[model samples]
Target: MDTTTNALRWVFLFLMHHPDIQDRMCTEIEGVVRRDMIPMLEDRSKLPFCEAVCFEVMRLGKGSPHTAPHTMKQDTEINGCVIPKGVPVVFNLNSINSDPEIFPDPSTFNPDRFLTGDGRLQGTEKMATSSMGRRSCMGESLAMMELFLFVMALVQRYKIKIEP
Candidate 1:
Protein backbone atom coordinates (compact mmCIF):
# COMPACT_ATOMS: atom_id res chain seq x y z
CA MET A 1 0.00 0.00 0.00
CA ASP A 2 2.74 2.43 0.94
CA THR A 3 4.73 1.63 -2.16
CA THR A 4 1.81 2.30 -4.47
CA THR A 5 0.85 5.48 -2.65
CA ASN A 6 4.40 6.84 -2.69
CA ALA A 7 4.75 6.02 -6.37
CA LEU A 8 1.56 7.93 -7.17
CA ARG A 9 2.63 10.88 -5.06
CA TRP A 10 5.97 11.10 -6.76
CA VAL A 11 4.36 10.80 -10.17
CA PHE A 12 2.01 13.67 -9.45
CA LEU A 13 4.80 15.79 -8.03
CA PHE A 14 6.97 15.17 -11.06
CA LEU A 15 4.11 15.93 -13.39
CA MET A 16 3.44 19.18 -11.60
CA HIS A 17 7.09 20.14 -11.83
CA HIS A 18 7.26 19.28 -15.52
CA PRO A 19 4.12 20.52 -17.24
CA ASP A 20 5.59 19.76 -20.65
CA ILE A 21 5.86 16.11 -19.77
CA GLN A 22 2.41 16.18 -18.23
CA ASP A 23 0.98 17.70 -21.39
CA ARG A 24 2.64 15.03 -23.48
CA MET A 25 1.10 12.31 -21.31
CA CYS A 26 -2.30 13.93 -21.42
CA THR A 27 -2.07 14.20 -25.17
CA GLU A 28 -1.14 10.54 -25.46
CA ILE A 29 -3.97 9.45 -23.18
CA GLU A 30 -6.51 11.66 -24.94
CA GLY A 31 -5.42 10.22 -28.28
CA VAL A 32 -6.38 6.68 -27.34
CA VAL A 33 -8.92 6.98 -24.52
CA ARG A 34 -12.12 8.94 -24.80
CA ARG A 35 -12.53 11.95 -22.55
CA ASP A 36 -15.57 10.42 -20.89
CA MET A 37 -14.14 6.91 -20.57
CA ILE A 38 -11.53 5.63 -18.13
CA PRO A 39 -8.49 3.81 -19.38
CA MET A 40 -8.45 0.01 -19.22
CA LEU A 41 -5.89 -2.76 -19.38
CA GLU A 42 -6.30 -2.97 -23.16
CA ASP A 43 -5.01 0.60 -23.42
CA ARG A 44 -1.79 -0.27 -21.60
CA SER A 45 0.22 -1.09 -24.71
CA LYS A 46 -0.91 2.05 -26.47
CA LEU A 47 0.47 4.34 -23.75
CA PRO A 48 4.22 3.94 -23.93
CA PHE A 49 4.93 7.48 -22.78
CA CYS A 50 2.70 7.05 -19.74
CA GLU A 51 4.51 3.82 -18.90
CA ALA A 52 7.83 5.62 -19.16
CA VAL A 53 6.60 8.30 -16.77
CA CYS A 54 5.62 5.68 -14.24
CA PHE A 55 9.05 4.05 -14.49
CA GLU A 56 10.73 7.42 -14.05
CA VAL A 57 8.66 8.06 -10.94
CA MET A 58 9.76 4.77 -9.42
CA ARG A 59 13.36 5.40 -10.39
CA LEU A 60 13.48 8.91 -8.90
CA GLY A 61 11.39 8.12 -5.83
CA LYS A 62 13.67 5.38 -4.59
CA GLY A 63 10.83 4.20 -2.34
CA SER A 64 12.79 1.28 -1.03
CA PRO A 65 16.29 2.64 -0.56
CA HIS A 66 17.66 -0.66 0.62
CA THR A 67 16.60 -4.26 0.45
CA ALA A 68 16.27 -6.43 3.51
CA PRO A 69 19.66 -7.30 4.85
CA HIS A 70 20.97 -10.39 3.13
CA THR A 71 23.56 -12.63 4.66
CA MET A 72 26.33 -14.16 2.62
CA LYS A 73 25.78 -17.88 2.25
CA GLN A 74 29.34 -18.57 1.21
CA ASP A 75 32.67 -16.91 0.55
CA THR A 76 32.41 -14.62 -2.45
CA GLU A 77 34.40 -11.98 -4.24
CA ILE A 78 32.86 -8.72 -5.48
CA ASN A 79 35.15 -6.34 -7.43
CA GLY A 80 38.12 -8.40 -6.20
CA CYS A 81 37.16 -7.89 -2.55
CA VAL A 82 36.47 -11.11 -0.62
CA ILE A 83 33.28 -11.34 1.39
CA PRO A 84 33.15 -14.09 3.96
CA LYS A 85 30.11 -16.16 4.77
CA GLY A 86 27.58 -14.85 7.33
CA VAL A 87 28.37 -11.21 6.55
CA PRO A 88 25.31 -9.05 6.32
CA VAL A 89 24.86 -7.13 3.10
CA VAL A 90 22.26 -4.47 2.42
CA PHE A 91 21.95 -3.58 -1.24
CA ASN A 92 21.73 0.19 -1.75
CA LEU A 93 18.90 0.53 -4.22
CA ASN A 94 19.11 4.36 -4.25
CA SER A 95 22.69 4.25 -5.44
CA ILE A 96 21.85 1.78 -8.16
CA ASN A 97 18.79 3.74 -9.28
CA SER A 98 20.80 6.97 -9.50
CA ASP A 99 23.91 5.46 -11.00
CA PRO A 100 25.13 7.58 -13.94
CA GLU A 101 26.33 4.55 -15.86
CA ILE A 102 22.88 2.93 -15.80
CA PHE A 103 20.74 6.05 -16.06
CA PRO A 104 22.14 9.03 -17.94
CA ASP A 105 21.51 12.34 -16.15
CA PRO A 106 20.31 10.27 -13.20
CA SER A 107 19.04 13.20 -11.15
CA THR A 108 16.73 14.46 -13.85
CA PHE A 109 13.14 13.27 -14.06
CA ASN A 110 13.25 12.26 -17.70
CA PRO A 111 10.80 9.54 -18.56
CA ASP A 112 12.08 9.39 -22.13
CA ARG A 113 15.07 7.50 -20.79
CA PHE A 114 12.82 4.52 -20.28
CA LEU A 115 11.50 4.72 -23.82
CA THR A 116 13.13 3.27 -26.89
CA GLY A 117 13.73 5.18 -30.10
CA ASP A 118 10.53 3.60 -31.39
CA GLY A 119 8.68 4.82 -28.25
CA ARG A 120 8.22 1.53 -26.42
CA LEU A 121 8.96 0.92 -22.77
CA GLN A 122 12.35 -0.69 -22.45
CA GLY A 123 12.74 -3.67 -20.13
CA THR A 124 13.59 -2.58 -16.56
CA GLU A 125 16.06 -5.37 -15.81
CA LYS A 126 18.86 -2.84 -15.29
CA MET A 127 16.86 -0.32 -13.26
CA ALA A 128 17.23 -2.28 -10.01
CA THR A 129 14.46 -0.26 -8.30
CA SER A 130 12.70 -3.51 -7.65
CA SER A 131 14.99 -5.94 -5.93
CA MET A 132 16.14 -8.81 -8.12
CA GLY A 133 16.27 -12.59 -7.55
CA ARG A 134 14.25 -14.76 -5.14
CA ARG A 135 13.45 -12.00 -2.67
CA SER A 136 12.35 -9.45 -5.23
CA CYS A 137 9.21 -7.42 -4.69
CA MET A 138 6.14 -9.61 -5.10
CA GLY A 139 3.90 -6.59 -5.58
CA GLU A 140 5.87 -5.20 -8.52
CA SER A 141 3.25 -6.05 -11.14
CA LEU A 142 0.35 -4.91 -9.01
CA ALA A 143 2.09 -1.68 -8.08
CA MET A 144 2.94 -0.98 -11.71
CA MET A 145 -0.64 -1.59 -12.82
CA GLU A 146 -1.98 0.67 -10.12
CA LEU A 147 0.52 3.39 -10.93
CA PHE A 148 -0.39 3.24 -14.62
CA LEU A 149 -4.12 3.41 -14.06
CA PHE A 150 -3.92 6.16 -11.47
CA VAL A 151 -1.53 8.27 -13.51
CA MET A 152 -3.55 7.91 -16.68
CA ALA A 153 -6.75 8.82 -14.91
CA LEU A 154 -5.28 11.86 -13.21
CA VAL A 155 -3.44 13.25 -16.22
CA GLN A 156 -6.35 12.66 -18.53
CA ARG A 157 -8.85 14.51 -16.37
CA TYR A 158 -6.87 17.50 -15.12
CA LYS A 159 -3.88 19.75 -15.60
CA ILE A 160 -1.30 19.37 -12.87
CA LYS A 161 0.36 22.59 -11.75
CA ILE A 162 2.82 23.41 -9.00
CA GLU A 163 1.73 25.85 -6.29
CA PRO A 164 3.70 28.84 -5.10
Candidate 2:
Protein backbone atom coordinates (compact mmCIF):
# COMPACT_ATOMS: atom_id res chain seq x y z
CA MET A 1 0.00 0.00 0.00
CA ASP A 2 1.01 3.61 -0.41
CA THR A 3 1.20 4.06 3.33
CA THR A 4 3.77 1.35 3.90
CA THR A 5 5.85 2.21 0.86
CA ASN A 6 5.81 5.89 1.68
CA ALA A 7 7.08 5.05 5.13
CA LEU A 8 10.02 3.18 3.62
CA ARG A 9 10.80 6.04 1.27
CA TRP A 10 10.68 8.56 4.07
CA VAL A 11 12.88 6.43 6.30
CA PHE A 12 15.49 6.12 3.58
CA LEU A 13 15.36 9.83 2.86
CA PHE A 14 15.68 10.78 6.48
CA LEU A 15 18.59 8.46 7.04
CA MET A 16 20.28 9.66 3.91
CA HIS A 17 20.04 13.25 5.08
CA HIS A 18 21.01 12.48 8.64
CA PRO A 19 23.89 10.05 8.63
CA ASP A 20 24.57 10.62 12.32
CA ILE A 21 21.12 9.32 13.19
CA GLN A 22 21.51 6.51 10.72
CA ASP A 23 24.83 5.54 12.24
CA ARG A 24 23.28 5.51 15.68
CA MET A 25 20.51 3.29 14.41
CA CYS A 26 22.98 0.89 12.87
CA THR A 27 25.00 0.84 16.07
CA GLU A 28 21.92 0.07 18.11
CA ILE A 29 20.74 -2.64 15.78
CA GLU A 30 24.16 -4.22 15.60
CA GLY A 31 24.51 -4.17 19.36
CA VAL A 32 21.45 -6.36 19.94
CA VAL A 33 20.52 -8.00 16.65
CA ARG A 34 22.60 -10.69 15.02
CA ARG A 35 23.69 -10.11 11.46
CA ASP A 36 22.76 -13.64 10.31
CA MET A 37 19.24 -13.60 11.68
CA ILE A 38 16.24 -11.50 10.79
CA PRO A 39 14.92 -9.28 13.56
CA MET A 40 11.83 -10.42 15.45
CA LEU A 41 9.25 -8.90 17.78
CA GLU A 42 11.29 -10.10 20.74
CA ASP A 43 14.23 -8.13 19.41
CA ARG A 44 12.15 -4.94 19.34
CA SER A 45 12.94 -3.93 22.88
CA LYS A 46 16.66 -4.59 22.69
CA LEU A 47 16.92 -2.45 19.58
CA PRO A 48 15.70 0.81 21.00
CA PHE A 49 17.27 3.17 18.49
CA CYS A 50 15.97 1.11 15.61
CA GLU A 51 12.47 1.23 17.05
CA ALA A 52 12.89 4.95 17.59
CA VAL A 53 13.78 5.41 13.92
CA CYS A 54 10.61 3.60 12.90
CA PHE A 55 8.59 5.65 15.37
CA GLU A 56 10.12 8.81 14.01
CA VAL A 57 9.15 7.73 10.51
CA MET A 58 5.54 7.39 11.53
CA ARG A 59 5.55 10.61 13.51
CA LEU A 60 7.63 12.96 11.36
CA GLY A 61 6.80 11.39 8.02
CA LYS A 62 3.36 11.75 6.46
CA GLY A 63 2.91 8.02 6.16
CA SER A 64 -0.85 8.39 6.19
CA PRO A 65 -1.96 11.94 5.74
CA HIS A 66 -5.44 11.24 7.12
CA THR A 67 -7.25 8.46 8.84
CA ALA A 68 -10.24 6.66 7.41
CA PRO A 69 -13.69 8.05 8.11
CA HIS A 70 -15.41 6.81 11.21
CA THR A 71 -18.69 7.64 12.86
CA MET A 72 -18.56 8.41 16.55
CA LYS A 73 -20.78 6.35 18.81
CA GLN A 74 -21.16 9.26 21.21
CA ASP A 75 -20.95 13.01 20.87
CA THR A 76 -17.33 14.04 21.00
CA GLU A 77 -15.75 17.40 21.66
CA ILE A 78 -12.20 18.27 20.58
CA ASN A 79 -10.90 21.79 21.16
CA GLY A 80 -14.48 23.00 21.72
CA CYS A 81 -15.66 21.57 18.36
CA VAL A 82 -18.46 19.08 18.73
CA ILE A 83 -18.98 16.12 16.47
CA PRO A 84 -22.32 14.61 17.33
CA LYS A 85 -22.85 10.88 17.31
CA GLY A 86 -23.31 9.33 13.86
CA VAL A 87 -21.19 12.01 12.23
CA PRO A 88 -18.19 10.82 10.28
CA VAL A 89 -14.86 12.34 11.22
CA VAL A 90 -11.41 12.05 9.75
CA PHE A 91 -8.25 13.05 11.60
CA ASN A 92 -5.28 14.63 9.89
CA LEU A 93 -2.25 12.73 11.18
CA ASN A 94 0.18 15.55 10.42
CA SER A 95 -1.63 17.81 12.83
CA ILE A 96 -1.28 15.32 15.64
CA ASN A 97 2.39 14.57 14.88
CA SER A 98 3.28 18.23 14.64
CA ASP A 99 1.68 19.37 17.87
CA PRO A 100 4.29 21.77 19.31
CA GLU A 101 3.61 20.42 22.76
CA ILE A 102 4.15 16.84 21.68
CA PHE A 103 7.18 17.55 19.45
CA PRO A 104 9.41 20.56 19.88
CA ASP A 105 10.98 21.92 16.65
CA PRO A 106 8.65 19.56 14.81
CA SER A 107 10.10 20.44 11.44
CA THR A 108 13.37 18.73 12.26
CA PHE A 109 13.69 15.01 11.68
CA ASN A 110 14.98 13.73 15.00
CA PRO A 111 14.44 10.16 16.10
CA ASP A 112 16.04 11.14 19.39
CA ARG A 113 12.73 12.80 20.11
CA PHE A 114 11.43 9.37 21.01
CA LEU A 115 14.29 8.77 23.41
CA THR A 116 14.86 9.91 26.96
CA GLY A 117 17.55 12.11 28.50
CA ASP A 118 19.71 9.03 29.00
CA GLY A 119 19.15 7.80 25.39
CA ARG A 120 16.72 5.09 26.33
CA LEU A 121 13.83 4.48 24.00
CA GLN A 122 10.69 5.97 25.45
CA GLY A 123 7.70 3.66 25.57
CA THR A 124 5.07 3.98 22.86
CA GLU A 125 2.19 4.71 25.24
CA LYS A 126 2.14 8.37 24.22
CA MET A 127 3.09 7.72 20.59
CA ALA A 128 0.14 8.41 18.27
CA THR A 129 -0.09 8.24 14.52
CA SER A 130 -2.67 7.52 11.83
CA SER A 131 -2.17 3.80 12.31
CA MET A 132 -2.32 3.83 16.12
CA GLY A 133 -5.42 4.09 18.34
CA ARG A 134 -8.70 2.29 19.06
CA ARG A 135 -10.11 2.94 15.60
CA SER A 136 -6.74 2.28 14.02
CA CYS A 137 -6.03 0.08 11.05
CA MET A 138 -6.48 -3.63 11.68
CA GLY A 139 -2.84 -4.28 10.88
CA GLU A 140 -1.51 -1.67 13.29
CA SER A 141 0.61 -4.00 15.41
CA LEU A 142 1.86 -6.02 12.49
CA ALA A 143 2.57 -2.89 10.51
CA MET A 144 4.60 -1.46 13.36
CA MET A 145 6.62 -4.64 13.61
CA GLU A 146 7.15 -4.62 9.88
CA LEU A 147 8.32 -1.02 9.95
CA PHE A 148 10.88 -1.75 12.64
CA LEU A 149 12.13 -4.87 10.96
CA PHE A 150 12.23 -3.26 7.57
CA VAL A 151 14.49 -0.48 8.74
CA MET A 152 16.47 -2.82 10.90
CA ALA A 153 17.07 -5.19 8.03
CA LEU A 154 18.39 -2.44 5.79
CA VAL A 155 20.65 -0.62 8.21
CA GLN A 156 21.92 -3.87 9.57
CA ARG A 157 22.86 -5.17 6.16
CA TYR A 158 23.96 -2.01 4.39
CA LYS A 159 25.17 1.49 4.97
CA ILE A 160 23.10 4.31 3.50
CA LYS A 161 25.20 7.02 1.93
CA ILE A 162 24.02 10.20 0.24
CA GLU A 163 25.92 10.90 -2.94
CA PRO A 164 26.55 14.55 -3.41
All candidates' TM-scores? 0.94, 0.87
lDDT of 2: 0.80
- Superposed on all Cα atoms, model 2 deviates from the true structure by an RMSD in Å of 2.0
Q: What TM-score does model 2 achieve against the real structure?
A: 0.87
Expressed as tens digits, the lDDT of each residue in 49-100 for candidate 1 is: 9988988899998899988888999999999999999999888999999999
lDDT of 1 at 4: 89
> What overall lDDT goes with each candidate model?
0.88, 0.80
- Minimal lDDT window, size 10, model 1: 123-132
User: Which ten-residue region of model 2 has the weakest summed lDDT?
Assistant: 123-132
